[model samples]
Target: MQDSNLFDDSQLIFRVLVNDRLEYSLWPTVAGLPAGWAESFGPASYEACASWLERHWQHLRPSGLLAKGGGRG
Candidate 1:
C-alpha cells in the first residue's frame, strides 16, 4: 500500500504485526510533509531495510517470478 502525493501533510507508520509472535512496528518519522500526508512506507534507510529483507527473503518471494523448481531463471 503506497501513498501518492506526499506534499499533503501526513504521518506514516508502517508496521509488522505477527499475531502468534509479537508485534513489531517500524515507523521512522520523516519530515517535509504537512501533518497528515506521506509517501509510501519508505525508501527505507539502507542497513536496517537490508537486514529485514535478508531475514524475510524466502517468505517474501514472488512465486510467479520463479521458475519450475523455484529458481529465478
Candidate 2:
C-alpha cells in the first residue's frame, strides 16, 4: 500500500504561520516554512489551527497597511 502524503492528509498535523505583516495561514508541518513567515501556533490538527487563527487574526488587513493610516487617503 502506498503511504499517504502528509500535505494531502487533513487528519495530519498542521501549524499556524504568521508573516511579518501578521497574516495567518494554515501550513502542513511536512512543508518547509516559506521566507518571511514563522510558526505562531500549533503542530496541531487543522481544525485547531483554524480555530486559533479565527480567534487571533480578527483583522484582515496587514499590520503594515493598518499602520499607514488604515491604508486610506
Candidate 3:
C-alpha cells in the first residue's frame, strides 16, 4: 500500500494570528488588488509593500490551489 500526503512538504509556514476565538490569516496586499482582497494601502506605499513581500517570500506559503502530495515525484 502507498501512503498519501495531502499537502505540500514545503518548508514555508503561513503566518496566522489567533486572537480570542477568531483566526486571522496575514497576507501581503497590493495598493490596488484585482478582486476579493482587502486594501491595505493606508501607510505603506507600493514599493515598500513589494520590498516587504520579497524579504519574507521564503516564509510565505503558496496558495493551496494545487494538489501537492503523493509519492516522490
Candidate 4:
C-alpha cells in the first residue's frame, strides 16, 4: 500500500547508491534504481540518509578516479 504521507517532505523516503566510480547518490525509492548501480543503505527518511552521507562520503571523487589522477584539487 502506498501512503501519501510518505511522499511528504517530513517523511520522504530515499535510498543510497554508489556507482563504479564510487560516487554517492540519493535516489528516490519510488523511482527505483538505475543500471550499473547498487543500493548501499536505504528506505530511510531523507534527513537520515543525508546524515549517513555526511558520515561516509567524505571525498567527492571516487577512489579509482583519484588514483587515476582525477582529483578536484
Candidate 5:
C-alpha cells in the first residue's frame, strides 16, 4: 500500500475554512475541521478552492483590524 499526502492528492476533496479573523484556509474534508474555523466553501477540487480564495480573499488583513480602520492609507 502507498501512503498518500492529503494536501497534494488531487483525488481527495477539500473545503475552504474561515476563522473569526476572516482568514481563509484550505482543509481536507477527510480530516476534522479545526477550532474557531467554519466552512466557507464546499467540498471541491483544490484548484476550485484556490480560485475561490483568489476571488474572495483579496485583502489579507483580518476583519477586526479592518473594522478598526487599520490597513488603510
Candidate 6:
C-alpha cells in the first residue's frame, strides 16, 4: 500500500484500538472509536491491522486479566 493513499477515504481504514479491559480490536476508521477505547496504532489498512495483531498480540487474554494486571502491566 502506498503511504500517500493510506488515509484516503475510499479504502477501508483500520485502527488498532484497545478497550478498558485491554482487549484489542480492529476498528474501522470510518466509524468513531468506542468511548473507552484508545488508538494503539491507527489510520492503516485492514491488512496492516491484521499484520499488527498477528505480531503484537502475543497474549490473546486481556491485559486486565487479574492474573496479568492491566494497562500494559
Query: Distance from true position, residue 27, model 3, in Å?
Result: 13
The collision pairs in model 3 are none
C-alpha RMSD for every candidate:
10.9, 3.7, 15.8, 4.9, 2.7, 8.2
Q: Each prediction's Cα lDDT score?
A: 0.39, 0.87, 0.33, 0.80, 0.89, 0.76
Question: Which TM-score value belongs to model 3?
Answer: 0.29
Query: What does candidate 4's lDDT look like per residue over 2-70, in tens digits?
Result: 556433554568988888888888877887689989998887888888889999888887789788887
Task: Return the clash pairs for model 5, or none.
Answer: none
- Per-residue alpha-carbon lDDT of model 5 for 1-73, expressed as tens digits? 9998787776678999999999999898998999999999978988898899999997988998899988863
Clashing pairs in 6: none
Tens-place lDDT digits, model 3, residues 1-73: 9774322222222222222212223332322232344433223433454454455444333333223533231
* lDDT-superior candidate, 1 or 2: 2
Give the alpha carbon lDDT tens digit for every residue of 1-73 in model 2. 9997766678878999999898888999888998999999989998888899888887888899888867643
Per model, how many backbone clashes are there?
Answer: 6, 0, 0, 0, 0, 0
Instruction: Locate the minimum summed-lDDT window of 10 residues in model 6.
Output: 2-11
In terms of lDDT, the poorest run of 10 residues in model 1 is 14-23
The TM-scores, one per candidate, come to 0.27, 0.80, 0.29, 0.76, 0.81, 0.69
Worst ten in a row by lDDT for model 2: 64-73
Candidate 1 per-residue lDDT, tens place, 12-54, comes to 4232222222223334345333343333334455345445645
With a 3 Å backbone cut-off (N, CA, C), the pairs that clash in candidate 1 are 9-34, 9-35, 9-36, 9-37, 10-36, 10-37
Which prediction has more favorable TM-score, 2 or 6? 2
Preferred candidate (TM-score higher): 3 or 5: 5
